[model samples]
Target: MTRVPFTASCSTSIHKCCLVNTINIGTTSLAAFPNSLALPFVPHTKATSVRRISVVAMSDLSKSTVLVTGAGGRTGQIVYKKLKERSDQFNARGLVRTQESKEKINGDDSVYIGDIRNTETLASPIQGIDALIILTSGVPKMKPGFDPAKGGRPEFYFEDGANPEQVDWIGQKNQIDAAKAAGVKQIVVVGSMGGTNLDHPLNSLGNGNILVWKRKAEQYLADSGIPYTIIRAGGLQDKEGGIRELLVGKDDELLQTETRTIARADVAEVCLQALKFEEAKFKAFDLASKPEGTGEPTKDFKALFSQITTTF
Candidate 1:
């Protein structure tokens, strides 16, 4: 599969089209095509084919300001830099919990220090924001009396410090409330794919119910009556490899796969895409990486999402 580069100078003119093509495997429709496929498929002229083109225009996203929470975390930091680097098309804001983190963002003028657990802290940054991306996740740290060198599980201590109850469930609620009050129209939340399963192994490290709490948070976002996209990512990893082309589907549908790890940078790209993808609004889906040579994902963001039905 070939990877498409996202450049700061990249731009496209939207057009509307209606086209039809039939293959022996199955019939498919192409609503938007840059040019006629007839020239390439002349040898297969016996196959059924239809041709049409429609055009629709989309406004430039460069003027919009996007607010991202948990800016100190891996995924949040990636999203901040990607959006900031494309400042010609997007205004990026990194919402952090500490002055040190604000400094890390290096006086971007878009950095806002705030905590998801406090509603008052969110008031300032959320104002006049066009979109919001929630990347906050409970991190594990070592606790007193725990020694990894001695074969002790320091993860338990870290999990204890990052309580999911206060940060995952309630903190998310606080964010939604603040968004509503501030008149924010769009939101994209990052969640885990196994969040509905309490029996998942990650929960064993923190508690039996960490995923359960995340499910509650997902439910809250669904009912918020705002334009939202909930991307439930598979096991996350931070590696140097490029993003693998992938298949996305309903929760837990892409299980038993070993290549599901997605880079934090790719997840951030999806979050940015969700901001302007009208078809992704009010939709929730799971994402997992596909194996090499799975073929390029022929579907664009809107086309892929239009196939799914959303509850909200």
Candidate 2:
């Protein structure tokens, strides 16, 4: 690194006054220096000689270590890839449940295989993490015996031991507890919209009560005393992101409008943006998007987060 030499000479009272006001080093101000670095300042009186000082600019601070649970999923994969792409900002790691999921990503050693439901299994993966993004949720699938051709509606069921209660509720609670133990700085959790209704149609899917359980986990995270951002996303679409205007609402209010669905990529972007802005902390809101090409895409994430005032 090149060291720049700064010179200060106070021959008159006017020169001393100018030195006391402020000193600008390139684009950095004197006040921006760390408290550990002691910079010389001119005394009240005028000096007789010029003082030359060698200034060595400091390097950038260390990057934060972030862990994404459920990195094997579609949205989680996006978040993990974004973090990795911004390597100067974060040290990204992925947590998956199976070897197949890990292989799917062609994951290096940074990817870990562990079950979130087993609290003991999460200890190692969660250690030393600066932030945690919870994306794990129970998935409902159609029962094999149900024939769509002969049925009014296909029957659904969660895999054995992977119901909403076990995955969304208990598993998320375990991750929260692990994060607390590890002293994580922040957490960003993604949940679905329509949680305000107790008898919503999603709850009837396999009787899993998915939204109810997800709401319970969100409430638990809110009460955990850690800074957090909770996003209750509307219907998830497989389309491209950043082509439609994103909207934020409270208590599923957006679900009543025509813009009730959002792309999975947009949701992934919001999860990352939440970590960049303090306004997103300790806030909860429903997220959706307008039809593609209707209006300008969302580029001001700080302003978007500022529009939300809900805590849960």
Candidate 3:
């Protein structure tokens, strides 16, 4: 066997009869290929036996200016950090409600104070954003052990602002309207499951019917005609992510009676992926985690997104 150096300039596939054998790509290794697949370099008698691959140079280092709603919250904070880590691809800004919330963002200058419930306050926050990643949700004032029927768990709506009908539905609508007004190209919203069935237990809390209002907002988003992706996640648990495999589906296809849950970090990772990939655009899907395992978790987010259906 012999090795040949590939130059910065090369050309091929100029005609119908193109030969695809023993191809060499830069920074690529044998481990990149599947074990059972036929090597493109292998001798092939017919065209059907070989698949064509286009190698285009990726020179676009330009980044999108992204604004994250609920940036002070659990998943929103993670999403903000992940976007900032990939600064070459994304310029991240955190939109928080109060000065205290703004201080939580690592003392970053990108933190902008704004409340989503008020349309007037949202314009400056989304003035020049290219994409909006919304992780905001109304906080239910109840601990894990708290039960409403047992003389506990009150103030599900919290203060004057944090109600489900206002935040989950109207707050989202305000964001959508602001995004459209700003000429933003894409909107990625993080919501939860059980938005379909009226009997789902999540609705019983505060009689808020949070999922129902969430669905209404989702429909409003879809009909807005903007390039959008809605990721309806399961129970949001505060745990370490990147270790479990991500599972996704459309129209609540993955929903069941048993409560499914996922880590905030994992959801944060998916929110970034949804913002970046065209495959995730114009789609709404449910997201959950499989479990802890020794095998590697799925990293091909575009492929994972493509398998799901759209939210028409």
Candidate 4:
């Protein structure tokens, strides 16, 4: 997936004032037009005839508060820490569903306890947030009367109160709707790799339709008209891998590949990079590890993304 570049043009003439066009990646561009300063450039580069024009590319996230949902999750914690480390450029806010979870987020003034299922709970943390990162997952333990050990229709448990659809789909809808109402411009979602396929093994575990439900949520996000990036991650592991690299492509295209696991830290880094990339917006892609023999990291995410055309 490639993000479309937005550009603007300006002209200046000699010695009135310096006109600066600040190119902010992943968001709006700021063109400071001067009332008096103008410098006319000559074709020849001479000391007297030459004029200087400086174009500064500023990041859209600088000093902006980003609201991260599921801030107590593994990926959410990493994202929060990374954003906070760049505090000079960003103000990080974490949204948790419980006061306990909020406490787990370490008392950052930016952290707020609120459930995504309640749209009303979203308004406060979402207010003035420039971007949102969604990392919500289903409730951890199996509900009463559902036994993972027995293996007798574990899928039905998803429909019995601990419904994946309610949490994954409706919960996501609530977030999207609240974010939209809050006037948020950018969103990055962390989703599972097999989400586009109902037949995928992971779906079979919770119900043959959990992935389908996730896809439904994806569609809602896509139709929202909000600039978004969806990272469909493969089996998430907490262990460190020898080399860190991301193999990105359109959904459901790269199946039957082993060694697709990626470290959670690398995934967080990719999410951060996506916030700055104009090309990453409005795109949904799957992330997995490259083959062992495929050595060296590639700088071009677009080129890697172009290799696959199919989506779910």
Candidate 5:
């Protein structure tokens, strides 16, 4: 038997040089190349397969300016901070409703004060952003004169002009419109998991119909024709992230399970991960996590997002 050698080259601006080396073991020719190549390993009939693998790398090194609406909120702050930490890949910007909220994040220059409910205020923050993460939601405040010691459920209500319809539906619609007009590439929306049921307990909170209105915005975003990722997270907890097995489902199915809550930090991480992967695009699903120590913590976000097939 005689050994045969052939030169195979891949041309791309992403890499200085991409070389594919083919070896013949008997009648079969196997191609060996860098794992960075986007193609799967397969037996090649000829050296021309090298051209097939000449595609650009999946990871984009260019920095994207990402704006986090509601950046003062628990999960939003985490996402904003994570992006700021990854300065090489992202130009992180935070949008808060008030100056006090801005001060909470150390009054960073990157933080922008804006009212998500008002489209006019969002213009400056939405300008020239490559992506937008919508973390804004209506807040429900408990009515006065109630105590936990009383052992009775406290009533809830949204402040004047801040109901679910205004904040969840209209505010989000405005953001979508503004982002679309700005030529934003991607949008990641974090919402609650109970949107499937109109009578879900959350909707009854403050007579706000929160989930109902949120579902409306989710659909609007889906129809906007812009690439989007909608994450309806279940029962957000303040626990540590990256310590539990994250799960995804559709139509609030995960709400029935005991593991129906996820950490705010994990939700923040998922929001950022949605921006990195193509599979996470145009997808919407319920997000939850198993109890810590029950299984291995979720690390491969690409695999986790690949499990979702739903659109809105």
Candidate 6:
């Protein structure tokens, strides 16, 4: 490791200001930095410095408040439990919609019963939150025996705030807006693959065109100017996580040929891992678990994240 002299200078109207210090890192440069992501990330806010700083990608989860929406849902529940495993680094909070839902969230998480569709309900839950991992969706309640892993179920056949347009698009948009207003440091969205192609099978449920709406929300989050990571997941299975090596790709490339499956628990792990990986910010990728006999799950998130083609 070597120490490099780091200086951040900003100019507004004919005035110039600079903050100078020496930083210890593996690699960085003044020119490459202007487009690079930084951590101990600076939040997007009026008080934040206009100049950008870049560091060799690293994730340090410490003394931050992380709020996970849809905490009562399958994926969110896993994230809620996992975040608590590192209680020294994060204050894990879960947002459910009702008292009944709150009771379903079993953990040391600070549970907030609130609806993502209602902006007013979100304010309190998002306030002072450092990071947000969004797993909420508008998928309609399933019919008995409707296993998403089984391949022929309508994934978004229900409505009443669970519709793709309402929950996936607008509800997610609401969460992004609230994150900005709260001055959140970062956000990670758990979205589905095939959203780039509206004709995908998963979109056929209830004529939902689910992927289309999810793309709208994805675009909104990208344009929201918040540091964001959008994990486009494959079939969300109910199997145990961390068993298979995760396959990660970009632009739905892997989804085009493989209609495979990944566990919801593993998706939660990816979302949690993105919290500290500065490399994942402003990037999106599609992920699915490999076959059962594949091998042990990859433990180095930064190594896996480094393999994705970053579009931002």
Off by over 4 Å in 6: 1-61, 107-109, 142-156
- Which residue segments of model 4 deviate by more than 4 Å? 1-61, 140-162, 291-294, 298-312
TM-score of each: 0.73, 0.81, 0.75, 0.71, 0.80, 0.74
Residues 124-221, candidate 5, lDDT per residue (tens digit)?
99997889999999999999999899798999999999999999999999999999999899999999998878889998999999999999999999
Predicted structure 6: lDDT:
0.77
Cα error, candidate 1, residue 7 (Å): 41
Over the stretch 37-84, how does candidate 6's per-residue lDDT look in tens digits? 343332344533335443322223225789999898888888998888
Runs with alpha carbons beyond 4 Å of true place in candidate 5: 1-61
- Model 3 regions more than 4 Å off: 1-61, 143-157, 257-259
Candidate order, TM-score descending: 2, 5, 3, 6, 1, 4
lDDT for each residue of candidate 2 in 159-211, tens digit (9 for 90 to 100): 99999999999999999999999999899999999999988999999999999
> What would the TM-score be for candidate 4 when compared with the true structure?
0.71
- The RMSD of every model to the true structure, in order and in angstroms, is 16.8, 10.5, 14.1, 11.3, 12.5, 12.0
Question: What's model 1's lDDT at 86?
Answer: 81
Model 3 C-alpha lDDT per residue in residues 1-312, reported as the tens digit of each score: 234333333233221122222333443422222222343454334422333353321222246789999999988989989988988788789898889977877837788888888899888879878899988888776535556689944544344667789999999999999999999999999998777789987788777888888888989999999999998998889999888878886666677724367889999999888876889999888888886773468798989888877664
Q: Considering only N, C-alpha and C atoms within 3 Å, which residue pairs clash in candidate 2?
A: none
lDDT of 3: 0.78
| Two-way TM-score contest, 2 vs 4, winner | 2
Q: What is the overall TM-score of model 5 with all chains considered together?
A: 0.80
Q: Give the C-alpha miss distance for residue 218 in model 6, angstroms.
A: 0.8
lDDT of 2: 0.85
**Candidate 5 lDDT (Cα, 0 to 1):** 0.86
**Model 3 TM-score, all chains together:** 0.75
